[model samples]
Target chain A: MSDALPGPTLSDEPILRVEDLKVHFPITKGIVIQRKVATVKAVDGVSFTIRRGETLGLVGESGSGKSTTGLAVLRMLTPTAGRIVFEGQDIAPHRGAELLAVRRRMQMVYQDPYGSLNPRMTIRSIVGEPLAVHGLDGDKKATREKVAALIASVGLLPDMADRYPHEFSGGQRQRIGIARSLALEPSLLIADEPVSALDVSIQAQVINLFMDLQERLGLTYLFIAHDLAVVRHISTRIAVMYLGRIVEIADRDDLYRNPLHPYTEALMAAVPVADPEVEARRPRAVISGEVPSALRPPPGCSFHTRCPRAMAVCKTEQPFLRKISPERAVACHLHTS
Target chain B: MTRPLLEVNNLTTRFRTERGTVAAVDGVSFQVAPGETLAIVGESGSGKSVTALSVLRLIPNPPGRIESGEILFDGVNLVKLDDPGIRAVRGNKIAMIFQEPMSSLNPALTVGLQVAEPINVHRGTPWAKAYEAATELIGRVRIADAASRLNSYPHQYSGGMRQRVMIAMALACAPRLIIADEPTTALDVTVQAQILDLLKEVTRETGSSLILITHDLGVVARYADRVAVMYGGRIVEVAPARDLYARPQHPYTLGLMASVPRLDGGGGRRLMPIEGQPPDLASLPPGCSFGPRCRSIIPQCRTERPELIQVADRHAKACFANV
Candidate 1:
């Protein structure tokens, strides 16, 4: 199996590296001059790296901090603390123009097609906005041609550039969004639940488009989604985020085939199978409780409340991400040395 | 054997749009025997929801209408009935669970009141009696601490819980047939399994037929006894669940099965995605709607739309090449 499609070698040098990334929103108290009462830690001390030209899938249920982590990676949200090393430079200290330059290299494709695209803007202008913003508006005709080509590249009609976003369907609008993200030729693309909004049939088309674009343009993708099926289809490596931290990280096949983390095992078991016989045979590991609130997550392991195999140690001591196998890293007392 | 609970014959639903009249459900036909589960599978605009709505005669008349069809429930055609006649049967004889519990359930009303309202309206039972019935119904659907949850509003319940409440509400009257429209689509996986299991169990206990409408083949495989695959407002394939999954005779059904990322098997090859998007319902092609995306489409497929032909005992496919 390895001979047919060799796994991409893991390199020490990563295109984008996030260490202890935290995004916390303050909950205020008074009417006048609000005092910070508590913080909702959307993403807390999460760390992972995306190698050049590799797809890293961030997967979890809603409010698992997967989307927050993706937004933090793009600098769309201000991280309270952490180091974001993009390419070779550290972006934590970068502000204003420096941050703007770094943002140009990292683009985001939002989940909702209806909400993301402006109804007022035509497809051409929507795609061309990034080009115009990046100080590439010198030749309007060439830019328009490029926008049309980008539209075509994402499997949309070239003439769709003239139509308004409302004129197109959900799938077509998503294609426009993809085109807009690619207008600047960004090195890193963070797609946050991009295909979740579309129909199951349309999801395949868009996922294929992502793969084709990645191969054709040598793009690195940090694909964030709750849909494990879609995640397994596109991702090279997968990071399982729970509450506000990554619980597991491994190659896609390795993670799917043999998940070490109990949280991951439960999640995989929960995925519905297409075949009835297989679904009946598949043992379901039902997590007992709902995910704890991020405002005040469980002290040690955020998943301990819902973890089926939660132990006494899982309550008091936080588990660090340690290598369970050569291909997998799991943060659980069960796997800890 | 008992008579089939619900039999829909040549059901056609249409809506008057700003552009023109649109036929959403075009000549669809199927049946759900007592205690059986029938799944109507389709993508967006395939009229799966419309067909379900038409059965209850809930299609808004100003724009939407059941142009032609016979929805026979226990040998009586629901299409021929007046508003009052249909109203008598809607909650008393048949009930429906919508896709989104958050939207379907009345947010202003308490969960108990919402579930009991059907009993109040249909049976003309006292409010207190109906409310007691509602609490009992909640417990029947497996909600923990049903008595406490009865006073809670729909917003207070989580997505899965709200869906359970919806199921509880639908089953409160113990209707002959329960029409569940993508009941589990909005739920997480574990919750989905639980909901599906609950529905299956409750239906079994009551001996009620279920019409499960969803786009997911996976959900159908788990819950459905019979499956109907819809494409461009038409039933492209209809078969038993196991038969359809094993040997999909229609090109559209086969494409849908192949396109989905399987939870079992498949060692890392990229999913074989259907080439093109779904056809524009307003401007459908001359022949088969799936012809554009079908891998093995022949020249004849472009000229004539194939009618469903029986390929096996209970399996049918609407494709010339496969038949």
Candidate 2:
């Protein structure tokens, strides 16, 4: 099933390219007259590219600014700095109708299935609402027919479209969300923790549906998640985030086998394998210390506090993200020439 | 071998919801040997949490009740304990760690006060000594600068730090058994590894058995000595951690393992998800609760519930299938 979709060729231009993106929220004090105390640098200087017909898994723990990066790419949350190039056009400065027009081309699938969908709206109305809002739906009758097909395409029966969000299970509600995202026939889908809220059994179904949809529709996905295993399964390439920085970007297998960044290596070691023998044999290189607050991040490398191999230079001098090979890039002092 | 630290026999818990009484934990049975870590693995609504709550007698009486069962902790029947008897045992002997540390820890009280409160109340230790013990436990859980941080509030601490405080509270009295319900679920992967290691290290030092309730199969593989795979309020399969992983007999167990994408590289393998939704307790199928979703269903599975029987030494399954 995976081989059915063609891999992104070198000649093809990337669908989306993010360059040194930074999203900083000013932490204000005082109720009436707020004064900016400090900036919570959420997505501080991150860069990556998502090719057409490929999955770029962005993974990190909470407060790692992964979700902020996704929202920044979608222009939902305005970037503090850097370029967001979508199909060779920088969409960072766009607003009003231009932004609305750009939104139709790309879509988002949220993490919480229960919270994302409107509880009052029926599945038919919810799915078709996007089409109507984008001025894609022809008429009421045409919208109904299109909604039915969308619902059916997501593995939900067309007849069930009349039911409310509460009537559907978590997995079903997620399918509804997927159907809604696909209503506009978008080229890019930024799915942030799409399967995190599902059961182990149900999560597989949703993932399979995602793969099937990608193969059929040739969709480009920005799959953001915290679970490394889930990310590894669905993503062709992965970017590891730590304290609002892209520490490493490499192919999924390469990242797993030869992680250059200390944070990435620690993350890989931290995730316990399912097999008992494998877990028993593997040496655990568990890193300590909690993630520092984004409000007052560490001086140099944000990961230096917990990194196993932190050099003196890592404590003061910030390391730039540089390509070690053609396909892999890492931001660490040890990898520096 | 040695006597079991805790034995739950045919435990059944029911909840009196608006929809009517439904058995959330139905005829569940398992044993946790002395110093052993037994994981109750299940998805939501599988009654894993209810089973733990039932053991501690923490279930709300109006809406929830332990319908029938014997929770034998250290050879004493916890189910037969009176109000004060259970109280003496609840925090003093069997401590529980919940998922959300923020909610579990008191926001109004200092970390030292809360952790010391249990030690003072249960052991009749002096306030000064209790505070000292609390500080030691805080240090034991690997919280840096434990003395100064003890005066800080829960909100001042991060999520992982709050969880460490929760662990410190759980370890105050050095309870013989610790029930951690999805203890690391709310934390990050790296932080989760640290917390689990701390829990294991502390439990080993105190020689306390642990009842780890979580849905992560990988966690069970690493920490648990034994595992109970629960589905629709019953133990579908129970075995040693290694045995269960090596050869999962129940279809539900097999499906769960297959569905989860492994971190150890199986990118090409397609996940074989179990079909249909989890069983609703209020209106479960007449025969097997998992009958509708069971891929290895037989005619008997639809008509009668299968009893858990010994398939191997220290291994049991509640399925009729030959697999």
Candidate 3:
């Protein structure tokens, strides 16, 4: 997983290209003189491409490092290794001013709307802060009008701009967060589980809002979520991650209908659909054990320990992402020659 | 069916706030048969948890009160039971599992001690015998190295493993009914499936009824034998799991099911989210609480509230326009 190269790229020049990205956290056991004892490979050799104006979903369980990947893509967490090419520029190596400029066009919306927002700040200030940070603030009156407009776009009334984050419910708080992310009108948005904290009915509203925003703004999205159903609804393409690596990447419908990787298949099967009849009939794909810790992952294939179809070769050699179809790629020994 | 193991009727629980008294669970009623899994599905403020809490008589006194309800267990009204009388049944005849295992389990005590508590208090079993029973209980929950792990504290296990400890504790008394509120909401999907399957397995093995409170309809579909959908502190719909999913009679239920994305595939329509936010419990709208949000609302919906009426052999809903 650590050595994986840039995965198969979808043609037509993607807006964001993540190649062999690795974000590792050092586990140091010292106070004054701290030394790295071990490394937790949070995002190990994961790669994917988001076509312009299309949403590429990154799906995985909690420990699979999907959030880490999103953070690295946003340049919030510096990757230990790899290239993040945004709009034809490898922004991964950029520093200070260069990074700041790149960040103006790439914003992130966090999972917990409450924690992500400042409790003390009003909605107007929260949404307009991004504009001020990016030097887009015109004047007091102009910023107020712009904030109101942004708030209206997310379906909240303009008067709500005067209220604090604590005054609103979870769904409305998420809307305020969305308004803030849309403040700069970033070309590429990384929505990290934006709807996970919402109630089911409210979740629909936020998800539909995302689709509408994408349509109107024509923005590329790196939508990261653990819920497969919601991901399928919003994303055009999906990358299934297993222990910090993309096990499979394919078009949304294609991946759902014909998952090639064992991990992908298991993930798809593991999702509990909302229909009892379908659930009763669907074959349960039971992966035997829990995901191994990222600090000391498996030798060859990270998913080998829990994979139902593991082989002797899977334990010895790490398989490269092999193409089974034009738009589908899976990194599993069963799919590899 | 043989007499329902648990029957609830006209259940109304209220909470006192600075503003006013809020009717959290308003005139809700349902039944759970022995060995059956009944899922009470709802959004965050829909009072599903309140209903479960009221059943267990676990609500905090001054701020919360079961205003009026008949929680009949084996033909006796639990609401009328004395404190000592109810304590005998709380963990012995009925057990409860909470959403987050971390908060539910005491960090100061060992896993074995926590699980053995019901046996120690109710059955009056000696500490040594209780611990022996607890070791067996943990093993039954499929926790590997159960005997050794008994010494481990709550923080020592993963989310999934900690939930196993909770389940082991709930099953310690072989209770006739188990009330699990969002049991797997905090765990990963794979672990969720595992825990659910284990919950279903153990409950069936002991012939105990389960009342599963969850927000995820997927979990309901997969785990529930029957489902009672709650909205605005009332039962909007109740039916056998398959029938409810097949032909939803309530507009709220229909909107709720349709609003969620489908892994199998979506309907022709993109998700049509419910129009408004969840109702504020303190001052709910006069008529139907769902009227403001429901799509198929007629003029009368805003003037007159609906009542749950029989739709089929075991199905009922409270919506007037949807039918």
lDDT (Cα atoms) of all candidates against the true structure: 0.86, 0.92, 0.90
Best by DockQ: 2
Model 2: DockQ score: 0.86
Report the error of model 1 at residue A35, Å: 2.8
* Model 2 C-alpha lDDT per residue in residues A188-252, reported as the tens digit of each score: 99999999999999999999999999999999999999999999999989999988998888999
lDDT of 2 by residue, B58-102 (tens): 999979999898999989999999999999997889999999999
lDDT string, candidate 3, B183-293, tens digits: 999988888888999999999999999999999999999999999999989999999999999999998898898789989984224897887889988878878999888
Clashes of 1: 0
Q: 1 or 3: which has the higher DockQ?
A: 3
Chain A TM-score per model, please list them.
0.95, 0.96, 0.95
Ranking of predictions according to DockQ? 2, 3, 1
Candidate 3: deviation at residue B248, Å? 0.6
Q: Clash pairs of candidate 3?
A: none
Which parts of model 1 have CA positions greater than 4 angstroms off?
A: A1-11, B265-268
Give every collision pair in model 2. none
TM-score of each: 0.94, 0.98, 0.96
Stretches off by above 4 angstroms in model 3 are A1-11, A139-142, B266-269
lDDT digits (tens) for residues A183-293 of candidate 1: 988999999999988887788788888998999999999999888888888888999998888899998988888899998898887777888777768776666556667
Rank the candidate models, highest lDDT first. 2, 3, 1
